[model samples]
Target: MIEDRPYTGLFVLDAGQGVAGPCCGMLLAATGAEVVKLEPPEGDWSRGLSVRKGPESVLHAAWNRGKQGLVLDLKDPAGRAAAQALAARADVLIESFRPGVAARLGLGPEDTGPDAICLSISGFGQTGPYAERPCTDAVAQAFGGLAALNQGADGIPHKTGPFVTDVMTGFAAFAAVQTALAARAQDRAAGRPPRRRVLDLSLLAGTAMLLASQIGEAALLGHSPGVPNVPAGCYQGSDGLWLMVTLVRDPDFVTLCRVLGLPPLAEDARFANFAARSTHAAELVPMVRDAFAGQPRDHWIAALQAARMMTTPVNSPVDWLADPHVVAVGAAPASVQGALGAVPFPAVPGQPQPRGAAPLLGEHTAEILSRLAPVPG
Candidate 1:
């Protein structure tokens, strides 16, 4: 068993709700932090998502595992007091409430112990016109300029189905927390205050940062170019499955031509080089697509591999779970359970599995609160 616990002995207060903040907490707990997920008396809203087995939803269970569950309604004075007490004792506190809500509730960074790392996560960040707006994953995608990039040309902007921006924000928060921890440590060694070591992060910023390359390309080129060259997208194989083939260089085009049995294209002057092939892509791509229609997906995949060209069947999520490669990789969950379950929880490269079951709503509140008795100074 690979036991990964770099953040061992670290206590984390997860006061955020929904995907991004909760995901941040999950990543932290997975890295060996003792995370306490503070939710409302009812439950975290994510518990209402995906397929549910009893009180637990797969989405909620998956992210909340390896953490103690505590319920506190910040709207209630007593609840707010409990939250403050927890924050005072925590090594880190994570909150995703709207801009000023945390401060109003008396659980904001300024309210926490000077050394506690308070990470505030939001859709647009802690300031700006959109900061206070109610934001979702799709909203962030559109606001961050990423939704406009789902495709090119046809004059339609589409939002990605996955909560890509949300997940990205979570990852950004994870990295920020680690960095903050390191910074605070260094500052303390230098006899500086730890409170000066961190700042909040936003989903919009994280998503936009991911577009650095694309934004640069758009600026330099001045026109949207879908994919370079031709036959570089999804196509239907004879077996009726979609396959993607990318031809980055001239030799790749030559190999693709040979595998598709369009040997003429390999020598054709109109398709001689990348620029020529791209210019005549409309003519060559359709012909190549037609050729691929003559062979099953496996036949083309094998032939393309044999020819040393790039080709792969585009798989749906279910298909991916059943894929031989995916199964061999331990990518999919062995089985979804409330806790780490019997399966090895999938982790980021080099990170070990953090183990714990998703607690029932407020399941640990009494125990957590009971254990919070004043420490002898």
Candidate 2:
């Protein structure tokens, strides 16, 4: 077990139930914060959404590691009061309910103690025109223009395979909280009262900001370039193995050609420059594909790397688990017994692997409440 540090004793009030808010709380907890996951009496909606064996659902494990759990019926007056009381002493409050939900429940930032940082994560921002409406990760992705840029075959826009919006919003919320903490520390050092702040993080806004490069291209030019515009795409080798290549500059293009045993494509009149290569991508891509198809994936990967070209093998999860680099880096640690029996989990970066399991529902309710109650004089 790793020794705990002083002053990192942050309390996280996770009023949010889904991936976005819980993910933010999890990151804080992993880094040695005292995170208290506040769940409703009926538990989070995510707990029963899909394939769940028990409290050990994949989603739950992925989002609630290293955190304590507490269940309170926020709809009840006593429950709401208890949550508000906890928030009054917390360093950070993360809520992902629709706009105005926390305020209605009497848990808004204004009701919290001085110097508290409130992070509000939502589909839209707290003050947007559509803030009152409910939305999901897919909805936010579509609304954020990312769907348009992620179009698949037949020109039909598609949602990303994973919950991209939720994940991005979680990362944004964590960043906002850290910034607020830094500001508060500065204030304390200056002999001033700690400054309280509210972060209004929206899934749509976070995802849009992430697409800044694509958006900028579209704003300056008539359209964003297509995926196969340059020597950057997956190619099938002759052995039926696939290799991913990314050539960004003239040197990269030359290196790609050298690796493929072809004359420098960058020196050719028809494919000499970015513009020319883009125009001739249809011809160039197939040539590269056919050349790569003549060799095994490992051979081409080595050849390309030797030429200083960027390349990677497209691998599935099984391949990733057995990869040499993954083993060398010790990404996956040995199975450990928690509330749920022995389970394999990834190790924390720069930290020893946590041996504790996720908390059962309300596992720390009695202990936490005892600490929160005032002592009689």
Candidate 3:
């Protein structure tokens, strides 16, 4: 219902593959930017990632909604020239090539107009010793300390199931591009000389940002610390359903124990406070698990809510879709129609839902290319 179209006349050229850069472009498009997604001849590699309905993958559909697609084989001279031209004319240009590839193709920030905002997303960074190193979401998670924090009960570090690092990097790039655009507009309004903005972002840096607090704690402690709150995790209920319970205040633990009818555990010296409970987590967690297992998930959830304790059923994706609150709030308000047929999507927070499906591979290529000036030899 929110008509948040602020970038009506802005032109965005998205020359990135995978999740991060496309996510940035998608967000820009949600704000009414005219985003042109430029891909290689085989198409954005994401199109073949998984669950492809012909040329459309779920990953591609999710991130690339509300954009026009243009396929160009940049290995060819004409393709490179066309991309450079698009980059030169764009208000914002996003690319995820290796450190120097964009520069070689003449699509770098230096090649663009002075007022352009160019965002370069990579595995490491644009100028580091690891600049050319290849990376993926899993790689970033492993290298950026998230895997360590995500260590399972079996003591094995695990990458998250979703593409978390790439998504976070996309959000970071989106914020950076918006900031640059705002700055450009302010300078223009003040009658100052226009300046080009080049943003260098990376999946590795984004993962670090995601684990900022954990990294800070590790630095301060000189060693890895245990989980801050003991027994504050998912527990299986009597009905064979799982629910997550978390405590922020020390008093909440006491309240939780009382709610679960384990007053003795609350009174135990070893579990007196958060620090004590964390120190004795090995002994305390199993008891808490046993207590939670004595009641159905709904019963515990109700009792905990009544006691002002933080808890909720660990809803699966289907459960989330059918949740009353999620439905009432219209969390996923848009249903995009495509080869997948009416796939529901959550609206971008504080922005309008995208008005179109992911553009087909080169859907508007001929129309868009016809409008461009002929490339000179």
**284-331 per-residue lDDT for model 1 (tens digits):** 778988988897888888887887777788987778778898788777
The candidates, ranked best first by lDDT, are 3, 1, 2
Candidate 2 residue-wise lDDT, 1-377, digit = tens:
55443226777788777788987887777666788888877777776664456565656666677778898888899888888899898899988888888987867998687889998988878986898878898898888788888877477999888788887888778778878988888888899976689889988887888788888778888887555348688888777888788877767777778778887565788888667788888788788878888888989999888877888999876787889998897787655435445555566555434435566778888888888788989
Model 3 scores what on Cα lDDT? 0.90
- For model 3, residues 1-377, the per-residue Cα lDDT tens digits are 65878999999999989999999999999899999999887888898887777668888999999999898888899998888888888999999999999999878888799999999999999997898899989999999988988989899999999899999999999999999999999999999998999899999999999888888888999987778988799999899999999999998988988898888998899998989999999999998899889989999999999988888999887789889999999887656658877876776887777779999999999978986967779
Clash totals in order: 1, 2, 0
* C-alpha RMSD (angstroms) for model 1: 2.8
The candidate with the higher TM-score, 1 or 2, is 1
In order, candidate lDDTs are 0.80, 0.78, 0.90
Model 2 TM-score, 2 decimals: 0.89
Candidate with top TM-score is 3
Superposed Cα deviation of residue 64, candidate 1 (Å):
1.7
Candidates in order, TM-scores: namely 0.90, 0.89, 0.97
Please list all clashing residue pairs in model 3, or write none if there are none: none
